[model samples]
Target chain A: DAGVTQSPTHLIKTRGQQVTLRCSPKSGHDTVSWYQQALGQGPQFIFQYYEEEERQRGNFPDRFSGHQFPNYSSELNVNALLLGDSALYLCASSLGKIVGGELFFGEGSRLTVL
Target chain B: AQKVTQAQTEISVVEKEDVTLDCVYETRDTTYYLFWYKQPPSGELVFLIRRNSFDEQNEISGRYSWNFQKSTSSFNFTITASQVVDSAVYFCALSMKTSYDKVIFGPGTSLSVIP
Candidate 1:
């Protein structure tokens, strides 16, 4: 089975523009998480979705939002992007044990906000 | 709040040599989980190991090993017989038992292997 997969491996957007990145979780995985990794720093969780509903969220702003499809695919939408928004958006999938489960990450979509 | 810290910003070791990467975390919660991940140049994050607050037992997997000490709040990883392919940016992550789905990552330690 395929691991977590992301779309638009790389994206270039202008300031104030909006962008949407996609992710498909690994088979048998029900939870999808989004993270933003700035250069030189580790990934920071943006949010997590389970059962097609946002189960939890991180410390990100309202501009960052997401949705989980019935098929377990997820989409991360960022609006009113700023230069600081330039970072690699990583998508990770795991089981919804409510505790800890091994995660599977995608290659990530590199978002460059100019 | 939870935080994962990797003291080493970068490390270089000769092939076949052994190297250790340190991960120090800060959290008031008594029960939580610690994890280590390897992100090679290919940019895919590979799950290496995960240790809970209760399982302090040191774990060994092939050439990889982890030492988890709750008293010190540290989970250190060591690579034995390091190979060139082992070079990558390693990240230490933490998740609380109450909210295991929410994980926080460290700054990361870049490991380089020299032939």
Candidate 2:
């Protein structure tokens, strides 16, 4: 089974523009989490969604928001993107809540904001 | 506040040599969880191992091992007979028992295995 799939492997956007990245979680997984990784740095947790509601969130601002559909597919939408948003956006899926189960990551969508 | 720290920015070792990645954590919660993840060149984050606050016993899985010490709030990972494929950026993270909490990650340690 494909562990996790993300669309638009790479994206280029100008400042103030918006971008949407997609992710399809592993089959049978009900929870999905999003992260941002800067060059040579570890990923920073953005937020997590379960059952269409955001169960937990990180320190990220509202510019970074996400949604999990009824089918479990997820989307990360960033509005008024800034240069700082140029990084790898990762989507992860797990069997249960991240607190108890292991999270599997995807290849990540590389975003470069000009 | 909760934090995970991997002090070593980069480490290099020859093939078949042993290496250890250090992870130090800080949290006020009585019960928490720690995890190690590997991100290779492919950019996919892979879960390496995990240790809960209640369990201090070190674990041995094949050629990899982890040492969890509660007294010092440290969880270290060691690789034996390392191979080229072992090269990757290692990250340490902590998860609190808070109702709405997310895992926090360290800067990461880059491991390079040369043949």
Model 2 residue A97 CA deviation (Å) reads 4.8
Global local distance difference test of model 1: 0.93
Q: Give one digit per residue, the lDDT tens place, for model 2 in A1-114.
A: 878999989989999999999999999998899999999888888999899999888889999999999999999999999999999999999865446567889999999999
Q: How accurate is candidate 2 locally (lDDT)?
A: 0.90
CAPRI-wise, candidate 1 is high
lDDT tens digits by residue: candidate 1, B1-115: 6888898999999999999999999998888889999999878899989888989999999999999988888899999999999989999999997788889899999999999
In terms of lDDT, which candidate is strongest? Answer: 1
Report the Cα RMSD per candidate: 0.8, 1.2
What TM-score goes with each of the models? 0.98, 0.97
Worst 10 residues of 1 chain A by lDDT: A94-103
Give candidate 1 regions above 4 Å deviation.
Answer: none
> What lDDT tens digits, residue by residue, belong to model 2 across residues B16-91?
9999999999999987888999999999989988778899989999999999999998999999999999999999
**A1-114 per-residue lDDT for model 1 (tens digits):** 889999989999999999999999999999999999998889989999999999889989999999999999999999999999999999999999647877899999999999
Q: Score the docking of each candidate (DockQ).
A: 0.88, 0.69
